[model samples]
Target: MSTYGSRGDVEPMAALAVTLQELGVEAVVCAPPEDEFRALLERAGVEMVAAGMAVKELIAEAKANPHITLPERARKVTSRQYEAVLEVAQKADVIIGSGLMPAAAGARTVADQLGLPFHLVAFQPVTMPSPYQPPVAYPGRPLPPDVTDNRELWKHDAESMNVIFGAAVNDHRVSVGLPPVPSIRAYVLNKRPWLAVDPVLSPWRPSDLLDVLQTGAWILPDTRPLPAELEAFLEADQEPVYVGFGSMAMGNAPAEVARAAVEAARKQGRRLVMAKGWAGLEAIDEADDCFVVGDVNQQKLFPRVAAVVHHGGAGTTTAAARAGTPQVIVPQVVDQPHFARRVAELGIGVAHEGSVPTSESLAEALNRALGMTRRAQEMAGQIKTDGTLVAARELGVA
Candidate 1:
């Protein structure tokens, strides 16, 4: 398995690797070489072959140089994958690609070179093209305002993909002695792509464009106990509202976002547990009513919380849902909006109107979320925890 992106993208692959190993298959992951990623795979007893640049460095560079085109960045990442994935592909019976588009493209070409079957998996349904939904617009390339038809928007989407990744992919293919692909979009996604999302949270509607295999969300079973401080806080009073933006650098003002979350939870007469994630959020002030933590296990903590206010990444959203915790989804970008909408549609949470949340907006959303606790609890029973086992069986590992 090979992937590159945030924790949301890499952690699922680690979960799948662990499942495959339990089924007597030797699983190795080629992913970004960040310490957190290495620790995650290490805990699963899986081998990690570093691929691509460090994700934090990539994000920082992108922010530093706003003028760098998407195509240029894609080319650099694709080149790195070609160099790193060759050794792993040589030993694997099959290749699986996920996360960023450029990384997947390079892995597919490596599979082509070695005559290995390549499968592309999406953690969310939004990335997969369909007539039921339009494609995610590329940065700096918005869809035409006049184009209302989904099909038309998808056509435009295809063109934009080719414009961004076609050359980078085709150039690598030709260098590897493989024929150049005509359409980068079709080349990567036309095969029966697998969608690794919970059917209840993000359902897939069939389309003519691609054959999709909808599997439940791949989850890493975390057994780590919460810290003593957090445990004491939970026992002291009413359940606190939990707020964290896992892996997201919460825009330019993370401190502002943290303050708003703290204020909102206070208005509802609830204590607050804030996670200082990649955004490095801190408690606005030192008080017994609020506790700040880092990289704790949500699986153990979410059930104790009154509500979850978060940037709606796939894994976090699914974790909170499985714990039967109501949510307030403040979506930032990419597939986050899709998850936000689904949470609202299920009546388990409120999708904040926009990304930047003030105290008033968060309090309002939290009020709505707290009222739907019963629905959330009922829905939790319907969430499947066997998604990793299912994926392993599908891969013929079990």
Candidate 2:
């Protein structure tokens, strides 16, 4: 198994590895060395072969060079990352991967070489060829509804991805002695596709390929006890509002988000637990009602929070929902806005316009979430936390 990206991506891959291991399937997770959950995977008894690239550094590069096109981004992934995946693939029976660029592309080549089946798991719904949803694009916005089977749009989307990453993928193929591919559509075709989400939060897209499977939400198995100070703070009064933008670089968004978080807490009369994620929130420093922290298990903290304010990554969204907390998502990219919409549609939360939001807007969102606490709790109760096991069973690994 291999994947790339932030905690949101790695954690689910690790969870799946754990499930596979429990089912007697030996699994090793491969990804760029900087994954936050490398330790989590190792601690959970899943072996990790570090892909040499630093995922955070790669993301920083991508963010810094916004002019970089998708194909360039795809081709730009360090050869070391692909090498690590190839090395690990040599010993595997089935190649399972997550993420679009390196993982799926690399796994496709490896699987073809070894005559092994390649399976994909992802938080993004459009990763598969979907007949129900419009092709995915950057930033959050509505798209024209699918009037019929979305295969053509899906093909267009796949070709666009090929344009972005195909050059680099072909280069790797050359190094691995595999023939270059003309299109990337093969990566999504006739493959085992798993959408790692909870249906209650993200309903199945009707346009998804008939073969696509739902793996449910994959959260870290460990929920470490909160620090004593955090424990005491939670007991202090009404639950605090949680403000975090997981894996998104701050790049000047921190101060704005911090002010909004503080102001929202003040307006709503709640304490704040602000996670200083990739976005290092500066205004969080001087706020008396706010407690700033680095990454901690949201699975443990969410149950105590009054509401969740986030960038709407899949892992965080599921964790918040299962904790029975209402979420206020200010989405920034693919699949995030989709999750935000589902939160609102389910009557459990609200979604902001985009990533940039003001204190007034945040306060309103928090207030809206606060009003639906009971509904959020009900949604939480209905979520199947055992999705990982279900996925393993479906794979027939056990």
Candidate 2: tens digits of C-alpha lDDT, residues 236-311: 8888998989888745667887888888888988889888888887545565678888767788899999899998
Clashes per candidate (backbone, < 3 Å): 0, 5
Q: What is the lDDT of candidate 2?
A: 0.76
User: Model 1, residue 96: displacement in angstroms?
Assistant: 0.5
Per residue, candidate 1 scores C-alpha lDDT tens digits across 46-164 of 89999988999999999899899899999989878877889777778988889899999988888888989988999988878788888899987799998989889988988888899
For all candidates in order, the CA lDDT equals 0.90, 0.76
- On TM-score, the leading prediction is 1
| Local distance difference test, candidate 1 | 0.90
TM-score of each: 0.98, 0.91
110 in model 2: Cα distance from truth in Å?
Answer: 1.8
Q: Give the per-residue Cα lDDT of candidate 1 at 113.
A: 89
The collision pairs in model 2 are 70-164, 71-164, 131-150, 131-207, 132-207
